[model samples]
Target: MSVIKVAIVGANGKVGRLLVSQLKNNNSFSTPLAIVRTQDQFNYFKNEAGVDASLTDIENSSVSEIAEAIKGYDAVVFSAGAGGKAVERIFTVDLDGCCKVVEACEKVGIKRFIVVSALKAEDREFWCNIKGLREYYIAKKAADREVRDSKLGYTILQPGSLELNKGTGLLQPLNKIEEKASNNYSINREDVASFIVQSLLHPDATVKKTISLVNGDEPIEKFIQSL
Candidate 1:
């Protein structure tokens, strides 16, 4: 038996780093692959984060430029985020870029797909809702719609407020809330990464399912599998 190969898009982000760490030690996976941004990121991510393996880099590359680099993976995680860029840029990456990657995945016959998305993307006043933030959410939702209908095995994770935290593996999926609800929750980026990886390995995983996540004290794997 061979360890499964996985690819991580936006492999330099917060959750991306944690994804790399989790994959390196997992028995079922090879060192998860990364589609990185710049030359600087290639070194920093590998050296600082310990993602060494047959990893490839598409530095400052567009989504279209990613196909050859990610050609032979079992799964691709879309963790590419806007990083406070212009609204237009956010649309370009979060929405259009994601679609392009999915197209590439189809072209190369890659079957498993996982997406990192925001929890309340459909709301008008989502927290941390800055000028272009709503646009970001809209774009992610549009891409999510595409994946659900694309006939591929896909999992879309819409996690609640993202916050700075040291890694903790405990995870809890959030209950779907109405758009006008006043409650809130935050998830550690590491836990978010773990959920994405687990979804990739499980064939019976939540395919065609879009789930929301929040920090919980329960074991992360059980919490997700029960969903």
Candidate 2:
């Protein structure tokens, strides 16, 4: 029951904030470090959320600088994204930012890495028909590939459309997920955060795996064990 030390990139984002709160309350981990872009964000996480915070902008930092930010943590979670505000960010934040973090992990010898990726990112045909998302999907696909090719032990959690609903603590089996149309694949952000916690706790089940997540009847632990 040794406590794990975790650092979360994009700590100011929705999923990142939930993860920081969950980790602080869970005995399995230390107060997770929240890596943020601004002094204001750093202050919010440190003061309001009661966690350690580091001011590190993933979009602008070099691999070495990012490595320095996350230096001593046992695990690193990459949940940062461009949020679709700009097309250029699709390349910089989603694709290149992910690569930089993977390289940073390698530079520092950190093995455990978890990435929040998009559902169906690997299937080009699936996203090709969707308007306005081609670039985003492309970035996600490349980022997922970068994580796979890296030496770091990685778990890529490709959850469906992120919703702000409450956590159900359940997930549809990955095999059954594809049976439905892509439109039905949405999951709550809270559930995604919970799954992230479970993934961190049970690295034996999650490391080096890419899992598809959506709300369902089976408990998170059961779904994890079934893996």
Candidate 3:
């Protein structure tokens, strides 16, 4: 139960920002390392957010370089993504970027890895028909597979449509959710961030598991116990 030093790869994103704040405020964790792609982001996380910041672009940096940046951290979280309609970026940032992070973690001997992936990415039939999102899901599926196949203790969180609502600190396992037919699965980004914290805190229960997330009535702590 020592203080865990965490390095978050996408600290500038919505959920990533929330994670940085939560981890920083928690006594169980040391200052979280924010790995960002630009100097502006680096400054924000370092001078403003008061956390260690690394200017490393996952899409451009070599695996060796990334390993160097993340070395000595107890865990690494891969939440970076190419957020937009740029199809080419989906391959570079979403796919190759994730693979490189996995390689970097392995090289550095960092075993605790968490990934933020899309819901239903495992079911190709479900995402393939969704217009404009097939490539993103394809990248996510491949990235998820790489993590599962790696030697690290990995947890892949697949959350449904992300929303901006306040986090209720509550969740429901995908399989237990009864409104699957409605196809309106979604969760707040803050809730997803909370779940990541819970996963990191309870690796024994979450390691090697890919859990689907959606906002519900169950508290995060209790929901994690059920995992």
Candidate 4:
């Protein structure tokens, strides 16, 4: 099989960092193009992670500018975020930025797009009731909608509360759970990153599907195949 060249937006973020690391370790994926917002971020990925990177301020860049930056890659990962509680920044980075990435991908004829979204984004009423997180959810929901409606082959992974602990390489498809238990939620950041790389490598895992993720007993590959 031919290797897939991927451009990771927000490659400096926590999950992005792990995704780059995992991709480097896997032979199926090419050395990812780490997309960041500033020169400093580009340097960090180059010097620290030894990955090729470029600067594209997503908040300000037009669809064409973003598309130009990611022109040759086979796929793009939309993991960039504002990383704060600020409402405006949330919309800018999560909603508008995600839409731009999708539009850019479509413009360039790159059909494989992966997005990391929050759990329960589909349930707006639940998120809106939770203080301080309404804006974030709103942004994610909007971005997710855009991807779902687009013609691109897309996978939206909606992992629950994220933990910084080491990955277990195990997970459960949320749809498989018979009961909507809260304990079924929550997954390690490392596992989430691994899943993203696995999903890219295994296109059948969750293509054109939005999956809810949580830590569970099933092996990652099996779980993905079952989906």
lDDT for model 3: 0.91
TM-score of model 3 vs. true structure: 0.97
Tens-digit lDDT string for candidate 4 (98-175): 999999999999999999999879888768887788889989999999999998999998988788999999887666
Model 1 stretches with alpha carbons more than 4 Å out = 46-64, 122-132, 173-183
| C-alpha lDDT of residue 119 in model 2 | 90
Question: lDDT of each prediction vs. the true structure?
Answer: 0.74, 0.92, 0.91, 0.89
Candidate 1 has its poorest 10 consecutive residues by lDDT at 52-61
List candidate 2 stretches off by more than 4 Å.
179-183
Q: Which ten residues in a row have the lowest lDDT in candidate 2?
A: 175-184
Candidate 2 vs candidate 4, lDDT winner: 2
- Give TM per candidate: 0.84, 0.97, 0.97, 0.95
- Give one digit per residue, the lDDT tens place, for model 2 in 1-227: 68999999988899999998999999999889999999999999988999999998889999999999899899999999999889999899989999999999999989999999999899999898889999999999999999999999999999888899888898889878965456569899999999999998898999999999988778999999999
- What tens digits encode model 1's per-residue C-alpha lDDT throughout 1-227? 78988888888888887788788889999877767767778777677766643233332354455777778888888888778687777777888778877887887888888889888655546644565466777887788887777757888888877766865777654543343134356777877877777787765867778887777667777776677
Ordering by lDDT: 2, 3, 4, 1
Location of the lowest summed lDDT over 10 successive residues in candidate 4: 175-184
